[model samples]
Target: MTPDEARTLLEQSLRVVVPDADLTGLGGETDIRERFELDSLDFVEIVERLSQGAGFRIEEDEDLRTIDAIVGLLSRGTPHPV
Candidate 1:
């Protein structure tokens, strides 16, 4: 997928994690953990849902580690297990 598409998906997934939070204008460089108040469970869930939606398997250890890293991974479309 393209970066724009991935970004949109990330925004949508993040909304699921924070339905009421205002994060519409945040850029890819924005730190989600600090900016969106995403806890460990929420982050994991987001990754899980995103991976499922993207038709891939994502692991918390191999996939998600930090907010910046997660953003990079999503934006760049990291390789995943099919």
Candidate 2:
């Protein structure tokens, strides 16, 4: 999928975790976890949703660290686990 498509998916994933979050106002560099005050479990939820939604496995801490990274990853396709 394209970056835009991945971004859309990320927004969907974020909303799944935080229904009332202002995802549209977030920039590319936005840290979803910090911005949303998400705990580790919440982040895992986002990762799970993103992976499932995009049909890929994101099995790394770094992979889901920021909105941009998540979008970049989903856009470029899945990366093999390190």
Candidate 3:
């Protein structure tokens, strides 16, 4: 997956979780936990969704400070145990 592809996936996934929010205004440096009202459960769901879609186990410990970084990591691929 490329960064653009990952971002599109992330945006789509995030939209599902935050349907009322305007995803177009989201910044690359926004802290999802504080900015998007996402809890750990939300993180798990997002990770699961991304993993299933990406064919890789995206780690939970990754620093997801920005959407760019999140997508970048997904594009680069992170090998984790099933």
Q: Quick one: best TM-score, which candidate?
A: 2
User: For model 1, how does the per-residue alpha-carbon lDDT over 5-73 read when each residue is reduced to its tens digit?
Assistant: 666777788788889878666754676777877788888888887786666766677635444466556
**What is candidate 2's TM-score against the reference?**
0.87
Cα displacement (angstroms), candidate 3, residue 63, comes to 1.4
Sorted by lDDT, highest first, which candidate order results? Answer: 2, 3, 1
What local lDDT does model 1 show for residue 44?
Answer: 83
| Most accurate candidate by lDDT | 2
lDDT of 2 by residue, 1-82 (tens): 8988999998888788899998667788888878999998888888888778888777856556678888888888866532
Minimum summed lDDT over a 10-residue window in model 2 is located at: 73-82
On TM-score, the stronger of 2 and 3 is 2
The CA lDDT of each predicted structure is 0.69, 0.82, 0.78
lDDT of 2: 0.82
Q: In the order shown, what is each candidate's alpha-carbon RMSD?
A: 2.6, 2.3, 1.7
The lDDT, on a scale of 0 to 1, for candidate 1 is 0.69
